[model samples]
Target: MYCAELGISYEIVPTKFDEVKKRPFTDINPNGRCPGAIIQYIIEQYDTEKTLTYNTLQERHHLKQWLQFQMSG
Candidate 1:
């Protein structure tokens, strides 16, 4: 959703979303980062203009903390 809102071009590869339990993707992404981490990474890499975030250094850290909280849950 943030990717779309930020105008980042992407495609839906249905095969990638296949049953993970049946066909684990650990072979592809060994680390297997959580959803929040992935989202935060995308925002950091693509939200260069900080449209979805803020320019303040403190705000960025706060965002990361929140992302971690989501991961913990």
Candidate 2:
């Protein structure tokens, strides 16, 4: 949804958590912390214009804070 807002195409790789801990997923993220690192990777790789994400430093900081809330709270 967010990626689409940024005009980026997100390719979904449907896999369970156990599968994510395996070989191919590890190649994408060694730590295997599924959506956190993976979504960040996708945003970085695909949101070339900084759309779907923060376009400025202040916005980036806000996004970081929001992510913390999202992941924890």
Candidate 3:
């Protein structure tokens, strides 16, 4: 939804990874988990924009902080 608000096009892909197969260690790091991996994959594959309304450091940092707040809470 944040991406949508930022005018970034995104899609959710179907996954077939069995959650049962992913154990304790795998779940420790969010990025190491299946769902996280899928998200990373999609982000890498889909992000083609070099700038979001012109890439300024302050604007980028604000966006990053906003995303952190959204994800953490």
Candidate 4:
């Protein structure tokens, strides 16, 4: 939903559950559970226009903190 709202195009690459613990995906995202982190990374790397997010230090930290809080539980 967030990705769609951001107008960030993405592909639904279906993979086996067991494959998640392997190489390429892990290479991109260290942990599968930290999806929020992955999304943030995507925004940083590809959302160069700052549409999905801004380029402010405090704002980015706050957003990261929020994402971490959500993943904590």
Candidate 5:
């Protein structure tokens, strides 16, 4: 959803349940997850050149806060 809004192309890679089981700590999270891990994965996958743009630092901060709110809720 966010990628579409931001005009970025993204693909959702599926993680196998059996593969996830090999890592014990993967399930010990809120909803069994962490935003940073997902964010890092996206960054690594799509932003390999680190070329994504933010018109301003404020926009970045605002997006971060908004993501935090969504995660918290």
Candidate 6:
């Protein structure tokens, strides 16, 4: 949705449970988890425009604070 809103070209690779437990996919996610880890990986790796993320240092700090708040409370 964020990528869609930003008009970025993205692809969603579907996977079976067995496939996700194998190589390549395992290389990307050693923990073999979905969603959270995957989303973070995707944003860090592919969000070159920083579309859904903060652009400035201050904004980055604020985002960290918000994430901390969510994690704590």
Highest-scoring model, TM-score: 1
Q: What are the per-residue Cα lDDT tens digits for candidate 1 across 1-73?
A: 8889889888865754344323366555554433576687888799888798998899988988887887665
**Native-vs-model 3 lDDT?**
0.50
lDDT of 6: 0.66
Position 57, candidate 6: lDDT: 95
How far residue 37's Cα lies from its native spot in candidate 2, in Å, is 1.6
Instruction: Give the Cα error of residue 73 in candidate 4, in Å.
Output: 1.8
Expressed as tens digits, the lDDT of each residue in 1-73 for candidate 4 is: 5667667677877788778667887887666444676777777777777776767899888888878898765
For every model shown, what is its TM-score relative to the native structure? 0.62, 0.51, 0.38, 0.55, 0.42, 0.42
Q: Tell me the spans in candidate 1 whose CA falls farther than 4 Å from its real position.
A: 13-23, 28-33
Model 5 C-alpha lDDT per residue in residues 15-73, reported as the tens digit of each score: 76445434554555435344555663564466644455344689767767766786675
What's model 1's lDDT at 30? 50
* Local accuracy by lDDT, each model: 0.73, 0.70, 0.50, 0.73, 0.57, 0.66
Q: What is candidate 5's TM-score against the reference?
A: 0.42
Report how far off residue 18 is in candidate 1 (Å). 11
Off by over 4 Å in 4: 11-34
Residue 73 in model 5: shift from native, Å?
0.5
In terms of lDDT, which candidate is stronger, 2 or 4? 4
TM-score of 3: 0.38
Candidate 3 vs candidate 5: the lDDT winner is 5
Residue 43's lDDT within candidate 5 is 47
lDDT of 4: 0.73
Clashes of each: 0, 0, 0, 0, 0, 0
Clashing pairs in 5: none
